[model samples]
Target: MASPAAPQPGATDPTLIRNFCIIAHIDHGKSTLADRMLQHTGVVDDRAMRAQYLDRMDIERERGITIKSQAVRVPFTKQNGDDAGTTYILNLIDTPGHVDFTYEVSRSLAACEGAILLVDAAQGIEAQTLANLYLALEADLHVIPVLNKIDLPSAQPDKFAEELAHLVGCEPEDVLRVSAKTGEGVEAVLDAVVEQVDPPVGVADTSARAMIFDSVYDTYRGVVTYVRVVDGHLSHRDKIKMMSTGAVHEMLEVGVISPEPKKADRIGVGEVGYLITGVKEVRQSRVGDTVTSANKPATDPLGGYRHPNPMVFAGLYPMDGDDYPTLREALDKLQLNDAALQYEPETSGALGFGFRCGFLGLLHMEIVRERLEREFNLDLISTTPNVVYRVDMEDGSEHVVTNPSEYPTGKIAAVHEPVVRATVLTPTDYIGPVMDLCQTRRGTLLGMDYLSSDRVEIRYTLPLAEIVFDFFDALKSRTKGYASLDYEATGEQSADLVKVDILLQGDPVDAFSAIVHRDNAYSYGVALAQKLKELIPRQQFEVPIQAAIGARVIARETIRAIRKDVLAKCYGGDISRKRKLLEKQKEGKKRMKMVGRVEVPQEAFVAALSTGDSGGEKAKK
Candidate 1:
């Protein structure tokens, strides 16, 4: 017996079409599943399809994570003869699995009507899985759970399915067990997707209404807004007005997100398309906004169009001063694609020229920092991440401070700091260690429960300021890197924390500083002063390092003076190299922010001061 005929193209039947996003915890086979889907759809021939076909960036491929959400249209043929083998457009959006980019995942889900929740058979559901599942449900998308990586030796599909049913409130039969690696049960998932997910609701209308889901900057073409036509049909050369800005521009190109960019003269309702207007920047083409005809307007704009705000901040500086312009250009290019990233030119007396960059979270900061170094081939010196704090002055004034240097002192006032609702999933055996680690980081346990026989989920209300720098690393270390953590910003609360400034020489290093707990101030200051002593090169005079608690010295160190004079002796023969070296040293000295006559290294501005020693001293006191 021969296999059934594949579904044909242009199947208008709703049962044939499927629009879904594949969401998973990091390394749980999302991209691999996407590859299989593309291959099964025959979009790319077997020879052409690569591992992570959707991840175009080297960093994404190397890191084994999808940093950005990508959309691809695949045409699949149903095996059933109900519609005599019809072709359907399977619009698949692959979203980032990391918690830091959960906001991006949420936005991408708004464009889709269904989600394929992928879980590793061995690991079952993780903290991020629960988080993304909740987001999908909140968006009202039909969730189809899939057990991925069943080919692994430790696969436990049945247990995972049971957990999925219990955790997500889904039926056990509804969870499709599949190995994306071996192509087993993948067709069942596709079939379930077509059966469960609804198609575009209404017919295409010529009326002006389009929802911009995402936008990207094209060097030659300009800003290309990726939009889904909800209530109208848009065509090339059509003049459209941005509902948010009221700016009108003629469409230069209309295309779908596919290989070679399939050009469409027009896109109908429920179809996703990319519109290239002459607009040079993507900031104006805000995500979640509406695009309408200049003359004909829609009744109302789409909901959920709030702008993303950055919660964490750090200073980004070039290792070499000459690379400052290159770093700035790279940042501009990066911001063209990411609307949430914010930055401003900041000069640190010790670090020279740098930018104070804002990110959604710590993961977002790491991705950006990695991308800068890998994509732009530039070495960067990054400061510790800090949370923005809200301060209420006694004069009835409110101020937002990102760096510790800007924090108010000697003022009678109230201060508010950000906090997060954090969730951690780890092995049951590691709970004790994890709890101990959380307490040290100022995390308050709100709740805990057994997620499974061996795994437990712990909930904590943590100060965002505490976890902004190294909480994730600490948690991973404590749990032996088996814990999966997710967090969302809850709100601001009153706190007695103050910015403890680390002064190198006599001037303050803005980037190496942070807003710290007043109780732990002296220790943090001392550690930082010690770190600077190790990082900065010795000069002619001994440089004094001090951590001051509001002008009172609490922790102090000193860099011993240099005694070598080899350059001074080589006055004639090695004069050129010596002069060049001296000039380079002078340039380096210029880069260091001078406190009085002492020069401090840029690294001193961002290194965390060790508080352990200071804490011990305090205990003795």
Candidate 2:
């Protein structure tokens, strides 16, 4: 990564300034409000500014969730004044509402001076809404509470406004009621933004200083750093330096994020712009770093821009070895945008060379897997997702084991695993069922509270390893998908845990293994063995499925030897059909990783399959 030249300072225009972000839950209409704001300001035509205009990614638009934080400058005018007097440059940032991307949302909020805290009229204030609202308040940003989705049939604006007032410690009249969908009261929200949200305070410093909020990599152009001018201006053709790494490079280009790149003469203080330097990779331009001129540097570097480390691990193998290079390239490209993702080469005796990938959470893992298959057009065989666990050694050493096959057998002293503080919001009617479900998953009930007349918030301390896979699905299934779950890492604690390793042909299948509590080891092993039996095809010889505790095999099963396979003589033009069938079976066999003669499907060992103990090892004669 090359360092860029410092930027020339530009004049500050306080009148043409506004900085704010829309903060809300997963589906509180934040993106929709962004679209309305763009349309109302005439920055984008009404027809062009469709719903969720800020969610440019295909995954976000399809899932109806904002994953990435986006910024767009819109021109808005006050209702009471003439066009000239009311004109303002509103820099609007659309942030992710999911808890997994809370770090991203926090970074987005730090770049802005004010936030529109959106709450759903029907749902009132959700757990995520409160979480993000507190973040904005902590940043000391002026928070403008807004009640959105008033057009819904279940709209309860009055009730939500009361809740909002109580939450924000303000009067009911202080909450702005608006329908981002129907465009009702939207103009009033805009008016409040300009009147309430303070303009950026100008700084007189001319030293090359800017804060990098977000960065992305382009194929043709190098690294593009999205920066908020904190104290000075930055222009192209000036030498710049990164305060943290001290790397320097020449500025290739600088521009704003319009439909197309609109080259800015210079981005002044409080303005947001992109710098296209020769730094071809995004890893060089980290988020939350200060950019300064090589000549005049800042005394203190900007901080709080660390990317989250992935707690979950999974195996990603290409269906064919031929696509190995392609898969590697795709992952590299994805990592350039998402710095949170981590991966390394891993090989199993059963499965060939593959990468063991890590993710921030389950959703992050799902998104990455989906992108590999959809965007890269590659076929993948993915293993079960597992949480990294701490294995205590007898020699007074500790190791974090992500893949269960790596866990030592005799060297264990005491093991500890990651736990999460989980909060589940559900209707009162479903509380009993939810509690039962949690207890079965070894959840320790911490506390409970009545959130409203019909809803209740239940808090529990659960092992992160247990909920890594199907807890969300199970909760939704029991609650009819009405429960909202939020969780954060509580800490690691000691537990009677052991790694259960599955072996095929005397070789451990890394993908089919997991860490389990000693109390539940037998049941977990039995369940996994049964899944593997169903997943693996019968071969020439019976294949043993064993789950071992140290040197002892606690549970076992066998995939029966294939007695019959190919059809005998096919006559009357049936030969081609039989040949095609054989070819298809061979292709299927190709997809499955073979340990000796037995073939295993990747889904058999998936984390979701470990939901219960009923589907355990099956014995075949």
C-alpha lDDT score of every prediction, in listed order: 0.77, 0.77
**Cα lDDT tens digits for candidate 1, 39-118:** 77677778887999999888778667788888887766666655656556778899988777887788788888899999
Report the alpha-carbon TM-score of model 2 versus the true structure.
Answer: 0.87
> Per-residue lDDT for 223 in model 1?
81
- Which residue segments of model 2 deviate by more than 4 Å? 1-12, 80-84, 564-621
- Report the C-alpha lDDT of model 2 over 210-253, residue by residue, as the tens digit: 88888876778877788888776777787788987889877778
On a 0 to 100 scale, what is the lDDT of residue 91 in model 2?
81
| lDDT score, candidate 1, position 496 | 85
Candidate 2: RMSD over Cα atoms? 8.2
